[model samples]
Target: MFGGRALATLTRYRGGLGAAALAVAVVLLGLIEPTEYFALDQFFELRGARSPVAPIVIVSVDESSFVELNTQWPFPRAMHARLIDLIAAGRPRAIGIDLILDLPSARGERDDAALGEAVARAGNVVLAAAPADEQAGYTSLPFSYSRTTPNLPIDAVRKGAAGVGAINTPLDSDGRLRRMPRRQWTGVEWLPGFDVELHRVVTAAGLPAAPLPAVDPILINFSGPLRTFPWVSYFQVMNGTVEPTFFADKIVLVGPTSDQMHDVFATPFTRGRDQMPGVEIHANALQTYITGQPIREAPVWVSTVVAVAAALLAAALVVRLHPLRALAAVSLLWVIVTLFAYLVFVSGHAWMRGMAGTLGLVLGYGVTVVDHFVREQRERRRLAQFFSPEVLNEVVRHRREQSLSSSRRMVTVLFADIRGFTALSEKLAPEEVAEMLREYLTETTDVIFKHGGTVDKYIGDCVMALYNAPLQDPDHVLHAMQTALELQERTLKVSARWEQRLGTAIRSGIGINTGEAVVGTMGSRQRLEYTAIGDTINLGSRLEALTKEYGVAIVISEFTRRRLNADFLTRELGEVTVRGRTQPVKIYGVLPADLRKHPRAVIDVSATLTLSGAGESHPVATRDVSEGGMALAGVPEAWAVGTRVEVRCEGGQLPGPLAADAIVAWRRGDEAGITFVALDPESGPIVADYLSRRRSR
Candidate 1:
């Protein structure tokens, strides 16, 4: 059933069920980019912004320095020559000028010559270049532009600088500079990026490139947030206001650092006002490439595997655990996964998809919670069909525990079947027959429940039930007898109604036996059921079958009769060999109504009695007595039949002491016949006491 229900749920919610599919779609379609960026920021925050790499420094031409220069926006190349000389004086390993001087200075050839002389003297300098698309050709003029080529320094500066490299930092769609294009094809040849070329010129031997495809560029592992690099203002360096040894053997990058210059960009390490300037991004890139630890992203297939595994694990946890606990567990799992990804990225220089995996896990947890709630409701409704409310509650309470192992238990099993069900069905239309059977079974089941019995199951036209099992009933046999009497009385009215409609009456038979039997959830695993089985149950069934032969509506075994508490009226039905037993079993027919013509036999005995009448008591003697009634002599001859009298046996010569309320049944002259009134369960055990005394004697 659970399997079928699962299949149904899948079919009902097909195509897209829960958050699992949504999460997968999100990852596949790149819909997780924004959220993932946020998560990546959090990871960076957790890792703590790193310290800037040493051996690299920025000489920024900040607003203060720009004003201090006291020149136009594009300062005279003569001034640039002075700054280049100042930086070159430090004997740095390399000097990279991030500003582009693609054209000769309009100031005159003297200014250009001044800058070129400085660049030529500084043999370790590299000039930045930019892509310029035009008619392509090689040129000695650095300022000359060409299609599919880079605009480089003026001829004077180009002839002076050691090498040229592209200063292009590519931004992702979000406008965040996370990666750099490693190389670009100029009309002449492929050239390395600014940082790569800087590393090449500094070390004089380029590092081995990664095993990445040509189209896929290198990811930047930013060393820290903005302004992390060691720095000195252009004015400070030129004015000689700082230590001269600071730039010794270090790589220096010079660029604008003023918002007025508009050289800032967003990066992963950006926080508050900490936007990175281009020069520092190049510094970080140089450090990353030189150290040979560029951040490497795993392939898409690897991310898919991680996402699926996390999702399945999360779903299982949600199904097995309570909701709040599952949420806490999932949160912990995400934290661990994110931390692992951070460790891998930081220590191993490999980027992993932590955010995508986390999305899958959270979605799985949510879907499983919803599915569990739906499944539980379905299970409750299905179980309602098989178990009563009380039983169902107990079963649910102990569902996690195994409580239904097969074991021998003492119980009373009852079987009630419609007599001549086949014959009755033949005479009526199919629908009418169904209606009649349904009504009879419903009433019979109600009677069984009224007596606190469990309807184990219905066998076609027969209703099998149990007592003192699944729940306990101390007076189970007496309860069974009461249930049978009520069914007989109730069905008689139903039979009468049916006889009027169909010209035939309905009749039912019930048999009850009490003993030990195996009672529990039985049958194979696939078809298991809660019921009972053993000789006692078989005997109950056989007894019901024998009811038709005995011309009785209800027959109970002697085992059941012996346990009654004297309130029920029953007549002995002579023993007969049942199908499976060697010995005959004594049976009794339970009477639903009084039988005034019950057989009476002659008996002569003197019995003492105390009588209550008119709110007074008197003692009398009995002429003769039978189980049906006692004939008392010398009573008021005027006492009429149906007179209510209460009697107590103070001391008697009969089989037992008796105390009961009785009614006058018959009388003749000085003799009156009185029968004992039927007692309730709580009343004193009259018949049981008599039987006990008889057994002792």
Candidate 2:
């Protein structure tokens, strides 16, 4: 039992659970490193260009330099020595050589000596080194640290340079250089990157060191596409065409930019054939540190939390809203997430993947919509058992607008039962009884559904139905009465067939009442039933029982009688206090034309009536007239259900002026039923003659 209850509760909140599940899935997918990297690259492309904080210049060994010097693949070390001496004379903060110089110069020992002497004269140069692939090392940190054998510059040149650091440009899976290590861990020592070593050289020259990123692989904040930094050709610098003063007070980065040299790699800002040179990439990295603004990645936990939260929120909202409105809401959320991510990337230099969250919103919406469709289809199947196809369509189409939650509504309750069914069932075989009941119930249900009534439930031989509930009906009372009358007519045919089979007839008693009642699906979560409960429904059931006492096929309360037009003939059965009720209820038996004893003459006459009890008078008209009683139309009140009233009729083919004193019998709407207590002797003959004339006509 407990498990059943728990299952029901979970079903009730399945939308939320589905959303949470989607969130978890999205978060897990977002944690993938490749996805994060891809998002980071997109953010870089969208952010476009930004100005670098450090004043840095690139000295490029371009195709023009190669042509101008007519030098082979490896330029003579004396040539580099001349360029270094000129840049050092300008008093630059630091000079970084991006080329690997781990081998002796092919131009001879003296050529290597010349480059070593020039690096000693400079006193503030950082040479690039590499990590040997065969020697791998390990560390215990959150991010991976590069561990390998050290590849250092030739000792003759390395001994003279201020620092020697690894030049490692790690590419994402897509083969794009976007990040670099702050430092590499060799077995014996930690070697900083080329840019980090340059920063050290600058600080060693008495400049304050900028703060470095704490993460091992620092995300390089590219300034822009290729050659964003100021560039001068090495050939121009060597031949005195470019002044050495241009390098003063700046960090100089010198590396090959010629396509022939093949020192270029793809980057976020560079696409297809437009790749950034290796030296320019190092310049951007150095500027990233010098500006103290490396792109910081948001914590994994934080991104996961945001994506999940967004998905769950989407689920909660879409589950309750219309499909079109939910789609619009999801689209708006996507825009907001994208804009927020972009702002953080551009302004704060922080990478927070928004694609996962936005994708979560989309998926959440889709799943909830699918779930809603399935639930609605299930509900449609359930409702089909209670409502006609037309009514069921209306209910399902406007379900969101008219929810089936329990609420108070003015409705007409109907109860019908086969008279003496218990005794009749005992006398028949079980199979016979089942067949008999099935045919009887099916016919009666068809009658109820014909008038748009909701079949609430069946209790043994009795069926309870409701009108003006789950859907609105302005003429619910009339519909219920019509259904009851038709059911009696159809039962006669059923009784004939059953009487032939069992030598006993079957008759059904129907009762209808209209008033305010609580109506909707009600019961425990495990088993819910759409039904109604209140005094009105109880009174309807009581009246159905009273039909046997009155020997009538159908009975209705005063509440229902008042709503009918003069077309329906009814006989008042006086007031009786039903079981469980202190107040007496007035009921009437609906009679067909053949059963009415005293037929009322249909007449439309203007008249005036005075209520002696209330001491009030009002203009009235006659709906019909009989010798015993008359229905007074336009009488606002019932005059306390027995108060004596004087009615006067004048003119309008009434023979002559007639007056009578009558006792109020019943009242409904603007009409009142009254029986004549006495008629003035002079007017008695006149009313009789007038009614006779109307009947003859």
Candidate 3:
């Protein structure tokens, strides 16, 4: 049993658990390097461009040089020899030629000899080399690479160059070049990168050298996109269009930059057709080495912990707040995380990859919103049982705190009971009796709901309802009265049908009162009921019981009668002491205009009626009379239905002439039906006494 209870409790809070799980899952997925690299690229993009620390120049073999020299493809090796001779004359600290010279020139040995001689004279040139094949191995250290063999320059050029460095630029899984291997293993020995070799040469010439990190492959702090460094055409340097002093003490890199060469690759700043050439990538890498401030990535464990903490925090906040407020709070947190990561990247030269945390926050918030919506729908379904649709919607929309809490407030309470139901049930089978009760209760509940009343509860043959408790209704008293009248009208029709089928007739009585009452959910903690308790409620119940004593279908307290907005016909039933109250409560019987079959005293009285438009008086004799209406004979045919007339009755135990305004209800031949529209104050007691004496006989 304890296990079952535990399972139920877990089911109730599953939404919160689900949100936390998804957040952690997303953080784990972000640990993959490729997934986090995208955020690093955005940091670079947001930082824009900066000046490189080292003085570097690019000898670009670009379109402009091709057009100016009138040359096509692979300008003869003698031209490169002339360009190197011009740069060497400047006494530069270092010169890196970013072209592979693994094979002899097609222009013959003399062509290759000329380039080799230029390198011999310069004594500071670094030639590019590559691996023999695509095969490479990973070392135990993070991001380290090794190659088994190298494809070096030809013997002639190799003998002259100061160093032959690997021109291998490694790309991440997404094909973006952001880091370079500091050195590669060639099985026999270690080979330095082209930029590393240039840095060594520059330091050897007595320039200060920045210490490199112990890590094998290092992130390059790229200053910008293509052409960020100073550039001069290769052909211009050969023809002396550029001065040699420009290369003095500067690191010069010579390589292809034309679109036809196809030596460019995507970088952090690459967008649309703009890409960085391989030579410029080497320049950026060399600058990073010279400055010794390469971009360092946060350890995997540190980033993972931060991501998880951020996710959990977001989940806690969203579950406690309203959905709209939660959305705003989550959005603010996302911005802070992104800005913090960017600041660390720019100022501290570190990359944190904060996208994981932001993504987790969004997912947590989204799932929590869905959970709230589902729970609200369930609560709505539960409340729908006791309130009408309109009242239920209002309750859900506003959700006032005092709606279900105990409080004292002015309200109109109604009690309705089915008369003679116990005696009728005794004569029928249990199934038949249940069916009868269901039909009767269904009709009564509908009428109460139609007038915007809350059904408090059902006690066997009785239904209790309240107005202006859970939701406010300024005209609650009037609404209760209307509900009672309509309820009785419908019950009479139902009773007639049941009488024909079961051989017994039934009726219902309603009592309504308006006063201060304590209304709300009240009972044990395990089971509670929404009801009213006060002397006002008790008095309302007493009035319903008095209906049988006074032979009336509906009764209302003086408090309720005083609050009615519209005129209604009622008869005072004198004051009586109720069961629970010391004071005698005044009650009135409600008379509906269409109540035609009420108890009547058979009597004949002479009466004269004046028609409103006929301008004459007519003589009529009363056949029978009730407080609501009277049956008449010997009426003129001109008195049609809905004709207004004045009625004055004399004699027949009426101590004086009783005057009242009435309207013709129905007519057949010379007999007309008259219903009292208004009665003089003095005429009320006279009519009551005459009917009382006639009933006594």
Candidate 2's error at 513, in angstroms? 62
- What is the model-wide C-alpha lDDT for candidate 3? 0.80
Instruction: Estimate, for each residue in 1-697, the C-alpha lDDT of model 2 and write its tens digit.
Output: 3455456445534765676576666567644556667777788878778776687899998989888999876888889999999998899999999888889998788988999999999999999888765623354555546546677889888889998988878887678898889887655788888888898887777666577778878888899998788899999999998888988888999899988788889988877799988999999998888777788877767766766667666776776688898888888888887888889989998888676676567667777678768876897789889999999877545533322358899999999999989999889999989998999999989999999999998999899999998899999988898888778667766876876778766778888888999987788745788888999999999999988776566789999998988768788888999988898989998863222334567666678899855668898888877766777778764354435689888877877887887756556567677767678998878877877777831
lDDT of 3 by residue, 197-310 (tens): 998998898778798777668888999988899999987887788988989999999999987898899999999889999999999999989888889877666666665666
Query: Model 3 misses residue 495 by how many Å?
Result: 99
In angstroms, the error of model 2 at 597 is 99
lDDT of 1: 0.74
Q: Among these predicted structures, which one has the highest TM-score?
A: 2
| TM-score for predicted model 3 compared with the true structure | 0.49
Quick one: ranking by lDDT, best first?
3, 2, 1
In order, candidate lDDTs are 0.74, 0.80, 0.80
Prediction 1 TM-score vs. true? 0.50
